[model samples]
Target: MAILIPFGLKMQAQNNTSGNKILVVYFSHTKNTKEIATQIQQLTGADLFELVPSRDYTTDYQALIEQAKKEINADYKPPLKNNLQGIDQYDVIFVGSPNWWNTFAPPVATFLTSHDFSGKTIVPFITHEGSRMGRSEADMKKLCPKATFLKGLPIRGSSVKEAKPLVERWLREIGVMK
Candidate 1:
């Protein structure tokens, strides 16, 4: 179930004719992160890009958690199967990731580091079990030092399917939506 997204949300697409290009880049192992990414793409009329690591991750939840922890602890950046180019054209970049060990996943780190966001505005959106953003935002700031960051939106992983209203409210509060 990708998106049985609320009807109101479908009606909320801004189509962003303000002449600023936007992009939504995300990595989702459970599809929870992708759910929110899709909503933001629909609402903001942004380009959508998925970060697929070179190798598929383990399906075992316990193993996945252990692997993610090790990667995070080691500050390892996994190679992605796909990379986005022409990044300079976008003024706002929405970075979506599932929080791993209190931070964004390693693939997301690779994506951020691979681009030059010196003048771009980075908007982070995370799906977490309970940590809620955790150190994700601060970590992103360190990785993309020249980029301006908006207050991040954190939705519980289990609640992503029902996150429409919260997503809308945050977009409006951030002046991305009217």
Candidate 2:
């Protein structure tokens, strides 16, 4: 008999061990961040968790922009559908999100505040059209003040599939891979 795993729970794990537990947590609006997160998980052998919002965003681009802008201006934190269990088990965390209005999506912020990241290493990655990393790193630092922040990677959302080499280079630069 074969065991079937649900798609959401199928986190990738490799045999490589660096003596540090790692987790890749991300919020993908258009699957761009999700793609990057998957690549990071494969490279670092980290567990993966997706940030799902209690309320869904619109699929329409213009509408999303309006909603995001409103939320950002209001400093809103949307409730999350699930919380990261066993968060203390990880020593290094890769937080990924799609850049929205020069910052991370509100759901990502919600996730960041929901955990205690003291002494953990936070490596940020963002997907953007032209804004690059935006204020994501700074914003995350504020939320996770006790966590060590590493240099971030920003990829063009449209070209996420070609981001493997870039991601690999970033992992080495951040000292996550030797």
Reference-based TM-score of each model: 0.91, 0.91
lDDT of 2 by residue, 19-40 (tens): 6878888999899999999888
The reply for model 1, stretches above 4 Å from the true place, is 1-14
To one decimal, what is the Cα RMSD in angstroms of model 1 from the true structure? 4.3
lDDT of 1 by residue, 80-138 (tens): 87767678878888999999999999999999889888989999999999999999999
TM-score of 2: 0.91
RMSD of candidates 1 onward, in order: 4.3, 4.0
- Clash pairs, candidate 2, are none
